[model samples]
Target chain A: MNRIFKQDVDNILKDMYVTSEMKSKIKEKAYSQNNKRIISFSKVAVCVAAIFAFSACVIGATSIFEKVKEKLGNTYETGILKAIPPKENTIYNNISIDTAAAMTDGNSAVAYIVIDDKETVKRIDDTAKISKLNINLVEGNNSMGYTVESVGYDKNKDTVIMKISIDGKNLENKEISLEATDIMSGLESKSYDTKGYKISDIINENATFIEADKGAYNTEEGTIEEYKMLKPDEINIPINNDKTIYISNCAIKDGKLYVQYKYKAEIPNQGSLYFRFNSGLDDYYNMPNVVRNFSVSEKGDICTDDIESKNGWCYIENIFYIDNISQSKDEFLNTTIFTEYDYYKNVVRGNWNISFKVEKLKDVFEGKCNIDINGVNITRYSLSPIGITLRGYSENENVSMYDIDPVVIINGKKIHIYGTSSSEWILDEYKNMEENIVFKYSFSNVTNISNAEKIILGDKEIIVEKN
Target chain B: MGVNIVQQEYENYEIHLDELMDKYGNSILRLCYMYLNDYNLAEDAVQDTFINVYRSMHTFRNECNEKTWITKIAINVCKSYMRKSWFKRIFTTDTLKEEGYNYNFNTNIDRENIVGEIMKLPQKYKEVILLYYYYELKIPEISQVLGIPSGTASIRLKRGRERLKETLEDWYYE
Candidate 1:
């Protein structure tokens, strides 16, 4: 480019001063990160990794986003808006409050936040699912919470406008503070203590118990061996007199039990056939692919996979992580498992039981990584062609966690870990693992383990297979 | 005791931050303004960029020049804003135009001022031309900042210069 052209582009937009207001807010956010008191152990490592991926996987959320169907009331009218200082806004990631003001009548307040775009909108929404937006109205001694009331894309303005609303309350002479400090994780989810109800209590013997021949792990990795019932039990529970839900063959691999079942619903079916919850919220065409995951400690955790309302039939595949189901046979089957959908008053109660044994796989490569992260020693490292596990222990001090994205870089290329249902790791560990945590990384088709170079574990790269 | 030390640490940070501001503050904002072609939006972006820089100060590997580091961060911030700009445009009115902000620079009329012409160029070419000439980054350095290969950076630089040359020729001769 010529000097004249260069000078011209260089002098396009004049520089502006960095206001002290932005600096103070930045300091506040930065300090919160610094002053963090407690760190929760990462429960799902794969889910955590997926968050860092380019675009978050938008499973069964074809509903895309929840809209603000509520009518804009007087609080949103231009006449009611009383100008407030710009301090009300606090920006985070991709969402920022553009216009924040109180109402003239002091009954309610509104703030408009502009989301960066759809990708950012997804991230914010997904992240907010775990950690909600930390927006609050500070009124004297009484602090009130605000909700994302309505969302619309102002096509004329080219911004995603999210209208935030505070509860209608008198603020005649209140120095109200509407501050969004940071987005916090732990958007709370409710887990219920499932009460027991027998099959006889819920349904009659007309329901069909589906069965299959000897079951192998769903896919043929050969390394990921599956357990099948030597003699499949005939299980048929009638939803009603005319139809029944059938349970068939099953397989277990990498701490998860996959039970395949099918149900035939009449187009004009009379009985209410209750289906079990599995998988995550990854649904398509109102029918989600089975990815609903539930967690159970010695206790139980269940993510409502999906409920597909088709014209005739509903097929179900329930996979439970063997690790999470740490109880004995009697304890597990006797233990009541509750799905999230049970919260909906009208939904069929899908509380179910588990009783089966799969011939488990033999360890392909049971070993340890000869390294440490910060201070913690990584012991109990093992690998099958199907999966790899890395567990660490620190007796004296807490282990400083690193992003342990387990990949076997073989022949100058990387083979990454496959999907996971649930896991406990350094980042999101329970207090027990604060001093000791186990990281489990599973792969789908890793045929051989001895064919690679070194495995990258943050700074502590360990040579797994020697050339 | 910990609180005291943190405050002291922040005090030290403030001093260092001021020095950084003196060096690259206005330049970074100017760079963003050129990229975004909007004043207020660029200001907001620069504010966020500095915040990011402050938070990630410990993470800067110092593998490249501080200017390159700041410029890289600024470009990323501007791109992110632009990424969501199309969405923002629909709701927000053109406050800049409403305020009577114009692009005219009173240069000698004999020579065509290239600001409007450069702004009108496709974004890729415009960015490369500005980075090479205005920021004075070499093609390799520009690649590092833009996260593109050096070969691609070179081609863009050449193409951008040729386009600017054609534009100038059209303005002056035609």
Candidate 2:
């Protein structure tokens, strides 16, 4: 059987083979990329080894800086992205924040910021996330909109390196500030089996029918509508650890089940809980036929004051619209409520601010094009050393702007835009059309546009020099 | 070593680009075609994989064979393409017809059914199945390629075979 299967496989893939043309294209692209950058691994060997000791199990001998670059698709092996030391690695509340490095291509900029809790008594693991982080790359009156995303966590250093990307504009000769008040870590999940319990066993006389201020999704209308949802004051169920976190209330209304979770407020806002119904089977392979819809709504606490003490504890409610609730309520009872909550792990409460200047590595190519891609207008675009950012307008929300693979051809060698880290579509209320549908596509390899050819979007090809 | 040293090593080892491509190019392309059902995406992934292999040629510690190491890179590149939202939005089953890659085999009826069933399997199972059966990689090699433990790889292979048996009625496995 195995031999037959193998033969079958070979026969199935018989037609698929790397032709001479494909081999030539692949070799040309790979070697051209190799010729652009000199491969030198010995220079950062010592520093990379020190960082690797902590994350040796995860990534072998690869530097954390390279990991950050890989995460942002800026994995160009070059000295073009220069590293600038922070003015002062600020330490507060037993935690430290420093700008590890930053670079730009005269278009957009990316900075690697390290938040370390090495001296703190709290433990930092892979689940560590810096919450309520506000990053501003300011130059005079122009403040660039940025997104701070976590690259990965180094368990050895008890630190997490975050990539703050400022897009849509040039960010050279500017100072960027990263301010965050809290670091949430150790996120975990717990499952509670609802084997023998029924719906009436939880909902009692104290249940109040209130307006769904949280907004419940109506399956029939296919829109969020005002429904009289039943809100139980107390679930009256014995939760072993009721002090830290518990399901405050749960009820069924309009064929939907609503469950509220309450977390005790800690000094650093310890626990924020969420609830989900598990299918009670193995992932993917054992997926059931029943597809349910659910929405989450959190109340009482805001993320602005990440560490400030709020007036009350945090309350998170999950509203699940059970299809054919009358018939499937029994089946739903067999499901488990998996309440995911993070422990009071390595949460440090202090504003660790860092302002750093980004140096431009190379001159960028910026141009405008009047191209239409399946009813979506492609207007302006910017090509940087790291990646390409295209700004366009789309009147139709149903039509995706990414209708075709955007191929950047340099000297006849075509490089596909592998993935996009960010794509922002802002609604233009005045023009009545979304003018700024920004798609920032990063190249996996170093892209030099000096001798570029053209960019193919959908079926239309736009000459780089003409555009 | 500096890049100039790498250039020297490339010449010293006689790792000719044409020779290396001849040895691994077809295998990697077939692996990528199975991994990513799209011919165009798989072609791009093949290029990216070779590019990565070229970039990290110096770091190829003999922990595993050259095939396993290169296969691992190819799988990672295919996964990166899979993560893109445009990958799903742009490419569909209709794409194979549109691109004229002969994605659906018109040769053998039974063989086509088996290959189609294997492709229809979830990514988690299909990956292990292809690596184990088609590539003839050992459990450890599959584990290294997928970045999972050997025991987990075995379990996935067993489960994936069981899933195939359930779906393919006339199919037999030992």
Worst 10 residues of 2 chain B by lDDT: B99-108
Highest lDDT against the true fold, candidate: 2
lDDT of 2 by residue, A68-161 (tens): 5543333345444666678667888778778877877665677777777757465666556665556665556344555444555666567676
Task: List candidate 1 stretches off by more than 4 Å.
Answer: A1-12, A15-467, B1-12, B85-113, B168-174
True contacts kept of each: 0.15, 0.24
List model 1 lDDT by residue over A215-256, tens digit each.
323211213223222112124433222334444324443444
> What docking class should model 1 receive?
incorrect
Q: Where does model 2 exceed 4 Å of error? A: A1-77, A120-122, A140-143, A189-244, A251-258, A267-312, A317-324, A327-345, A363-382, A390-400, A407-416, A419-439, A444-467, B1-174
TM-score of 2: 0.47
Cα lDDT of candidate 2 equals 0.57
lDDT of 1 at A350: 17
